[model samples]
Target: MPTSRFEVLGAGAFPMLVHGALILLLTGSIIGSLRKIPADAYGRFAADVVAWGKAKRLVFVVFAGLGLYVAVMPVIGYTSSTFLFLITLLVTLAPKTRTALVVALVLALVFSFGLNWLFAEVFNVFLPRGN
Candidate 1:
């Protein structure tokens, strides 16, 4: 019945608006809570924040890798991408090998199957199976 691939102001906009509003609400809530915390907590909390900021290099790298994974996932397939993402995260974070491997395997399975299921079944969006 539809002619064009997309119709102006269709179903997609609602999700986008909802997500945006949720983000705004969450940001407000976090800011409000942080402000309400006692001033006595500031010394330790500020030190932790500074330490975290100083330790952000690896964090940035991981985020960059996530961007790369998203870019490549369409070509490599969800399972492969998920495995790479999980393994990369585990290795870079220097987790204990036994726990890292277990966590990586579990994460890969969850991401590949669970996310795929969510997209295909819950959202009715078909994510590409590059393989």
Candidate 2:
């Protein structure tokens, strides 16, 4: 609901401003930490960066999947989208084992349907529906 460039506040403005401030604080903290590292210990920073690089692909995939989930929720409805997202995320992150897979599937179903039921029946706050 922002109108003018000079406008300081509006609906959603507070959360947006807080999010930006948090990002800035995190960036500042990372910079400060890196600065405190001695020049001779630069290898430590490089090693950390390398470790992050190795995991960057998985991170990107998870974020991209989340974006797709948000975009499709209105079309597919909340229950289906939530179930799919949870299943995919759980399988992707969990250890590769039969027990782990079974547990992930069970958890995904419970969370997706249980939360939907709770919201609709108890809280009386129905999420968006495709039908």
The pairs that clash in candidate 1 are none
Q: What are the lDDT figures for the candidates, one per model?
A: 0.81, 0.88
The local lDDT score (0 to 100) that residue 115 gets in candidate 1 is: 89
lDDT of 1: 0.81
Over the stretch 47-78, how does candidate 2's per-residue lDDT look in tens digits? 98888878797888798889998998899888
Among all windows of 10 consecutive residues in model 2, the one with the lowest summed lDDT is 1-10
Tens-place lDDT per residue, model 1, 5-120, is 56666666778899999999999999999899998887798798888877887878888989998998899887678777877786677666888778777877788788888999
TM-score of each: 0.48, 0.60
Model 1 poorest 10 in a row by lDDT: 1-10
Error of 1 at 1 (Å): 38
List candidate 2 segments past 4 Å from native.
1-53
After best superposition, candidate 1 residue 7: deviation in angstroms?
A: 28
